[model samples]
Target: MVAVVVELLALQVPENGYGSINDAKVLAFGEMGFGIFGSFLVLTLFFKPLVCQQPNTDESFVFEFLQKMGLNPPKDYGFSGSFCSWRGVFCDDKGENVVGLEASGLGLSGVIPDTTIGKLIKLETLDLSSNRITALPSDFWSLGSIKKLNLSHNQITGSLSSNIGNFGRLESLDLSFNNFSGSIPEAVSSLSSLQALNLSHNGFESAIPTGIAQCRSLVAVDLSENSLNGSLPNGFGAALSQLKFLSLAGNEILGRASDFTGMKSIIYLNISGNQFKGSVVEVFEGPLEVIDLSRNQFQGHIAQVNFSSTFKWSNLLYLDLCENELSGEFFTDLIHAQNLKHLNLAYNRFTKQRFLQVDMLTNLEYLNLSGTNLIGEIPSNVSSLVSLRTLDLSENHLSNRIPPVLAKNLKVLDLSCNNLTGDIPLMLIGELHGMESFNFSYNNLSFCASQFSRETLEAAFIGSVNSCPIAANPDFFKRRAPKHRGLEIALVLTISMVCLLVGLLFLAFRCRRETRMWVVKQNSFREEQTISGPFSFQTDSTTWVADVKQATSVPVVIFEKPLLNFTFADLLSATSHFDRGTLLAEGRFGPVYGGLLPGGIHVAVKVLVHGSTMTDQEAARELEYLGRIKHPNLVPLTGYCLAGEQRIAIYDYMENGNLQNLLYDLPLGVQTTEDWSNDTWEDENNGIQNEATLVSWVRGLVRRNQALLAIDPKIRGTGPDAQMIEALKIGYLCTAETPSKRPSMQQVVGLLKDLEQITL
Candidate 1:
């Protein structure tokens, strides 16, 4: 080897004298050893095409933008080619790219293919919500390392593009119920990492966009029902100071309810049916857990809204201001709403308020004041509403009695048209055990010494007075004298006067239990008669009277007759032993009793429960077309008792009960318009009392038509036939809202036979 390279250049001849081999330091040590082997062969051919241009360390780019939003990688997916083994892809751990995709409800439809989302330029998070995506391709906001965009309930329409604020790392934008209309974008208030914006029910109209107070990390804003009109944006409660759920319900927004007292970090505030008026007092401060200012036009006195501090509603739970015009003294600001659980102030005007200390709402479950103008009396401690399930003081103006502690755990009690008298109140038939529903129709209360059970007084009762003269009373031979006690007392008063003269020669076997009256001749039959009472049935001339003292407290005389052909075993034997002492009231449509029939008259029964085959065929076709119509403000049908499956109907029995126990039970200051005026019954019956003075005289004919001062004596009136009380106000307008507008019983017997020929 040339003498071993001449002894290795004489053992590298610079060993002893450092200056010799310095030819430019051996040409800089052979050009630094060929520049370290040509920089390791040009870094292995310049990183071998960047290690073959990366990618498969488990192919990611958010598994190609979740295979372009269609979310792939499932077949035997053990994906070591790691988008962390794909499947809703979420990478990171050297396998590079793709941060997260979420892929909710993934039945993903078309249109997200921008070369698998521009290879997810290191995407951070993109959740394709609900998915069936309609459009979104504008390079889909170039991702800009997106931070959370959920296109909710998609049908995604046009409008939203202010370059969608280029999603400057969007924090949470749901775009709710999508069909998005215009007027929201001001570049979505530069999203400063929007906290949670759900543009509800989209089609958003004017107002509301003060650029949404520039987001400022808003915490939840659901612009409800949209058509959003003006008022609300005065820095909308300090620009959403971390708001916690604010729903501007059914917007039309007419301001001034102090503009909702500065939102105070609202905890679910629903500006209900907005048209909001003044004096909503304290307008909320905080702690509210759900406040729906229903139907708004809010007038004063829900105790001037100062809800007894604790930030006004210390974690309140649902307080809906039903049909507002709110009046005062509702159980002292509704027992200060102690965490109330739904208390709808229905049709307000709350008069003479005395819910006799509503057991201070121990978490009341729902109490609606139906058609309110409330008068006192239901106070048997209202059975302390042990979480009452629903008790609507129907048509208020309450009365006395019928408060057998409200049938224990009443399920739905609606004391219809009240005035509530004696008789029918036998501790409401041994505490109605968890009653299901009950409504004492057009009351004056008299089921003639109640004692229910004939399958619970044929399911309860309806209308058509004195159950056919108490079933043509011979009084079952006076109850066979308690089954013949020593057969004496002059042979039981001569065998009950020879069984009441053989029950008046079978008075046609008691004319199927008499008392049926329907005398409408015509008066345009008063707006298709629905049912209040007084009698009518096209009367040219017809009089059937058997006065056993007017048939022992008659009332329960509804007779236009159709009640679904007829069944429930004919209302369990005409009320004979439906005698749980003949219960009396418990409402909503469940129990009301006092049936005597077999000729002793006095009937009032109503019972409705049995699960539901579509609400028992719509309450047996609305009580068989309201018992085959017949009017006089229509509350007739004085006959019906079926039994077996149970369904009883028989009305007529009102000695004044229900019109809410006579506006809450009379007594208090007792002036009720000078003790129920019509000139105090035209100075005690001289003018022969005419107008309908009950329900406290129609609340003094609607407080003398709003001139106020009608005070209360069961509405001191003796003048009603105003065309049969305006055709019984069309059964309160057929219970309003759906149910096909209600006037059917043959249009309520031709409008109560034209309101008895226009009240004759």
Candidate 2:
């Protein structure tokens, strides 16, 4: 083109016909240059818009498409605006073309529109995951420039057409959790650029596609949860040398571990929940990070595998070979897997291996060897696992004592169905301060020490034959029992002893000590009364005695002050003669009932049944500490009623129920039937009075009534303080998990104060 222009200029110079040809050439050349410039300008004007149109208008199309797909763009973002500025969309500086689209969880339903998508010729990536869209249009394959495609967790159906093999630039393809069925087309082998393929959780049937092995660039293949049957294709491992994460779980692929030989880079392999049989030792090589060959019929002693020497699974964090027939010394090779965090060898016949060692696994957190026929006592060395949280040794032949040290830092301990005997150790109770669930059922445990003895422990061992003595030795029982068997003889001896001791020196000594203590207590009471002035004792002593009598078979005493005491009849009357209708709440501690005293005060009485080794003095201290502390949100303890073996504490009644009832109430769409008729009302009408209930109820009520009702009267005219309500919401949140997750009373107060200031 430059040469043509130069030739035209030379011709123009000659046509000028001047005496000085050089000057004529200059003038003609300048004119020719202007003409060429004009032509170029015209061409640009015709083609620039046609090829690279205004980015604003193109972006508007993208925005409209996303909105049509139910994606709400983030604030201040749109087409014509930088594509990179839009939510879930990315583009180059020119912003003239769409480069990427990652619209996930948008509730998008229906097929992707072809018109808008076809125009995005420059698109390099597209991810429309977790939507309701079904079926990718054939035109989608026209975007040959795409490198990544994710259409997971959608209702997308139908098989991948052969046209997908034409995407020469594609690297990653995720079509998981879809309804795509039928054999993977052989043409998929032509995608030389494919690096990762996730066809998991689909309906893909028929034999393992041999064509998949042709993709030499494949690094990860997840064909899990499918019906892909028949042995894996021959040389499948050799074909994809770089494969890392291969999961064929929940499939029908029948093969031995030897079938996975050539895949040396494989780090995560889960061929579990299938019919894959034979010794797992065949697949035991490489630097595996996670291996789950569970729920298979892999036979042979685990010792035969030689895992420690062959496979340096030092990086392995999760190892699950449960429900297999692999027997032999357990945890023998596990010492090398110091990094293992989750180990499950449950439901295996590990009979001869009486005890498994885990002291070396300092990082181990979850260890499950349940139903493994393990015998002998749990080793004391388990105390080394300071990071351990869950330990399941249930359904084993483990006899003798449970290690006291193992309870420390342990959260969930299941020793159920074991042959463990002897008294539950006191150190175990102390160590389990953070325990959430402690199951010792079907064990020969005589007693559990601590405050749990009277409630949780007693109830758990209700039908057991062994009598758990209060004291440590049988000699204590013999000394406490009556010496004579005859009733008349015992009565005569008792009368003779009383007559003989009436004027004895022992009686005088006892009187002197009693008088001294009485005087000291009297003085202390007077001093306290003077300092605080006269305060009314709202609860009646007589009511406490009467309620205690009806609640238990033994006699009881009620104390007006910390030092004063009265008899059993006072408790029964306070709780309306132990009426079942007065029951307030029941938990691991026992049942709490509503009580009205003669002084016209209402109290909540917690009655603990007798059986545990916890002493009455310990219960008193706990209740006392709870009573002295004051918090508006916390229920307050009043006093305690103690019987011969029964223990009860009193607290203020909370008219509104606990937080559990409020949040866990049945939500919309829960199935209802005649069998569950009685639970329906309780489930539906879960305390709607409190702020937590009000917020949850408001959300649900909006769906039910389709509108907000009058603002809850509790905060009416308070302008619906969003901040305060959200702060109060934390109280409800903390109670979501176990008592441990529930924040300390101090934290609860602080959170409430902060949330109280948020603007709506």
TM-score of each: 0.25, 0.53
How far off is residue 186 in model 1, in Å? 22
Give the residue spans of candidate 2 off by over 4 A: 1-61, 71-84, 307-310, 431-433, 449-760
The alpha-carbon RMSD values of the candidates against the true structure, listed in the order shown, are 30.0, 24.1
After TM-score superposition, what is the CA distance of residue 742 in candidate 1 from its true location, in Å? 61
Worst 10 residues of 1 by lDDT: 539-548
lDDT of 1: 0.58
Predictions in order: lDDT = 0.58, 0.66
**For model 2, what is the error of residue 239's alpha carbon versus the real structure, in angstroms, after optimal superposition?**
2.2
Kindly list the per-residue Cα lDDT of model 2 for residues 1-760, writing each as its tens digit.
Answer: 5456455444533231211222222334465677666654454444332233233354655655665665544332333233456678787678666788877887788887765665677888989899899866657778888999999999988887888887888999999999998877788877898999999999998888788888889889899998888888888877777888889999888888878887878899899987778888767788788899998888887775565355885788999999887776674677878899999999876655667767678899999988888878889888888888899997788898866667367888888777888776667766555787776766767654434544565434432334445564454456533555577677989999988987587778855543332110011121111111111111223333443434443323233353333334556777666664565544445556787755566777876643134555455445544665656777777677556455777777766665434443334456555324223233435554433444444433332332225245677546754554443345333433223224445555555555555665
Q: Tens digits of per-residue lDDT for model 1 on 140-253?
A: 777777777677887778677788887777887777887878777678877888788878887877787667787867878787887878776775676676787878888787
